[model samples]
Target: MTRTILTEAGAQTAPSGDALWLSAADALRITGWELKPEGMCRGELCVPLPAGMAKDGQIDLAAFWGHIGAPLAHDAGGTVWSLGTAASERRQSLETLEAPDFTLPDLAGAAHSLSDLRGKKTLLVTWASW
Candidate 1:
């Protein structure tokens, strides 16, 4: 869950406080991942970004967020970007995916498909609060 940070031509990280500001477009270009005025691009996929760029030429933060179904948070100073949550649920690649399967027990104490609990042991555990 690492994020890319963009800076001026060769900005340095501050030793005691927040880093210097990066215009959104510059940040995106350098990282090769950005929510730009045209859209969000990674490798080759482009989602039609729905808002205009800011007066200063950065992508409009709020509109880009809305387009991606992601949430935004800003510090007291209003420096903001998508919280990076939207794509958190996405798969980085299809390298490891197994089919879904499961099983459960019935009140009669008989195990059912959960597929009939085939090739597996069905444990019946119950709990109650009185």
Candidate 2:
């Protein structure tokens, strides 16, 4: 059986277990992290993984996710996981006091993005189902 891996970007199907054991390709597809001899790397950022973290040449998804300070949550069966942004990244975003850029249609059906008004005083009104 395979577990459903969910991230803000998208969802992926990965091997199921108490923890996910992923091949290098699967890791990249799901989390954009590459398991290398030196560490888990994404582009120029290389995070030195601890010894034995990649046993049998497979990356432990849960271990590496938590190791990088991201919060991971799964169901009782540990078959569905939701990976959140890393704490440091979240903190940095918060420090900026800026909402993430998004696009939406206006009354005239014109598409506009928050980023388009980066310098202007833009008021965003949002409502959600809680």
lDDT of 1 at 100: 28
Clashing pairs in 2: none
The models' CA-based lDDT, in order, is 0.46, 0.83
Models 1 onward score TM values of: 0.39, 0.75
Clashing pairs in 1: 102-114, 103-114, 113-116
Could you tell me the C-alpha RMSD of candidate 2 in Å?
Answer: 3.5
lDDT (10s digit) by residue, model 2, range 15-130:
75556777777889888888888899999989998876787768887888888989999888778889988878988988998788767778899988789887788777878789
Off by over 4 Å in 1: 1-24, 29-32, 35-38, 51-56, 80-82, 91-130
How well does candidate 1 match the true structure in TM-score terms? 0.39
